[model samples]
Target: MTFAAQVAMFSKLAEEKGMVNSLEGNLSVIDRQTGNIYITPSHRAKCLLTEEEICIVNPQGEQIGGTGKKSSEFFLHEAAYKARPDVGAVVHCHTPYLSAYAFAYRDFETPKDTFLSQIFGNIKCLPYGAHGTHEIHQGIEEALDGRPVALLGGHGVVCVGEDLEDAIGIMEAAENYAKTIAIKHKLF
Candidate 1:
């Protein structure tokens, strides 16, 4: 699939999952061969993002193409890409249930469900850092440590994968697992 289509698909998925409302989350894709990064723009609603709204940045974080301003969180994507050369795409979102766990400083244990286990592996919690700051980017990079997903304290979650679809699937699985855990906790 084209990069634009993947961006649109992820935007819609984020909206559908309520992970992002009005541009609260970001998605990025890296061209492994060329080191070009494509990402969603800041300030645009995720549900309404179009192909043109995506921004292209080089490995150095310089905008080379596309429309709109790159997300302030572009540094987070850059840091992750630099740390994990095997990762091709990253998805970051303020998923409520997961963020709740983060805000509470509770590590999200792997859910007992087989599907969740198979998909999410284990999600590690990272220290709190200022949003859009280099510190937060570094924190995420450290948290990755070869893991596919990491929960940012008092912030959100980041999922990295070999491509856009894999990244999105990880995010979706994490959120679903978090939601299920929240429901079960409420019941007990």
Candidate 2:
């Protein structure tokens, strides 16, 4: 698939899975040959973004193409790529279950059920940082070590994978398990 098509497909998947709402989430894929990162634009609705709307940015976070601004929270995605060379895609979403944990600065436990447990090992909730700032960049860098998924304190969730499909699937499974746990806690 084309870069924009992959992003649009993943963004739509995230939205359908309840991991994206409004303009609260973004995805990025790195061009291995050119090293340019293509990220979702900041101001568009999750479901409304088109392939041509994706923004290409350099390693230093400078915008090179696409209309409008790159995601203000681009640093989170950038940091993931910088920290893990193996990571080709990053997906960030302000899904409700993850957001609840993010707001509380709580770590996520691997679910007791085998299916759910396999989706997450341990998820760290990084300390709170203001969005689109270096503070957030530092937090993401510190929390992303040795894990494919993490919850950003008071922000949302960030997941890294070999590609967009892997990244989005991990986020979807992780977030759904989180929501299930939340509902279970309410019952018990």
Candidate 3:
């Protein structure tokens, strides 16, 4: 599928999973062949995204192509891609359950749930960093050294994968994992 189609699909998925409310999350895909990156615009609702609103930027986070302002968290995407060549897409979302765990849990490894274990092997929590700041990007890079996903302390979750679908799947699995943990804790 085209990058725009993938972004739209993931955006809807984010909304369905309540990972984002209004315009809270962003999605990006990198063209491995061209070193180009396609991403959702800043401040646009994930559920209401459009092709024209997507921004295509270079690996350096420059506006090489596309419409609309790039996401303020573009550096986070850049850092992840730069750190992991296998990563084709990156998702940053305020998935409630995951975010809750991020603030509450210090070392949240893969959940006991089979689906979570299969999808997101483990979730590392990066130290708190200012949103959209260089510190946030740096924190992500350090946390993702060899991991596919990381939770930003008191902020949100970032998932990277070989493709957009995989990245989105990781995000979904993370939220489910967090929800399962919450339910289990309540039951105790």
Candidate 4:
């Protein structure tokens, strides 16, 4: 599947899994061959997102293709791609369990589960930043420091992976892990 299609599909999956609402998340995949970034558009419903609505931007964040404007949170994707050359895709969402931690300004501690601990190493909640501003991306690299997922303080979660499937899987795992923590604390 094309990167655009993959993004559109996983975006819908995110919505179906309660990772994001219709207009509340963004997903992007960097074409390994072209270096073009295909991302979800701003102000669109993920549940109904289509491949045609995907926007393309160069590595420098300039629009080079597609009809819709790039997402306002494009800078976060840019930072992740720049910081981690191995990352081919990014998934950002306001999942209820994870966002609860963001709202509380709390970081996650990897549970005793061996697999979860290996996959997620104590996700950090970066300091709050104003959306659509550079402030929102400040310290993002450090927050992502060798980790696939990071929580944007008072914002949401951002995850990176080698590809669209990998990114989406990481997002699902992260959300489920957060839910486990919430259940443990009776926060649900």
Candidate models: Cα lDDT each = 0.81, 0.82, 0.78, 0.85
Compose the digit string of candidate 2's lDDT tens values, residues 1-188. Answer: 88767887787777777677666888989987888898888877767777888888987678988775788888888888888888899998888887789889899887566766755667889888898986775655656777788888888888999999899888878878888888899998
Give a tens-digit lDDT track for model 1, residues 22-139.
7588998888888888888888888788887789898777998878789889988888888788888998988888888889866788856677776566677888889888878656
For candidate 4, write residues 1-188 as lDDT tens digits.
Answer: 88888888988887787777657889999986778999999988787888888999986778987777899999888888887888999988888888888888898888766788888888988888998777776777887888899988899989999987899899998899888877878863
Pairs with steric clashes in candidate 2? 102-154
TM-score of 4: 0.92
Which sections of candidate 2 miss by over 4 Å?
112-115
What's the TM-score of every candidate structure? 0.89, 0.90, 0.87, 0.92
Candidate 4: misplaced stretches above 4 Å?
A: none
Clashes of each: 0, 1, 0, 0
Query: CA lDDT of 30 in candidate 2?
Result: 91
For model 1, what is the alpha-carbon lDDT of residue 70?
91
Candidate 1: stretches off by over 4 Å: 111-115
The TM-score-based order of candidates, best leading, equals 4, 2, 1, 3
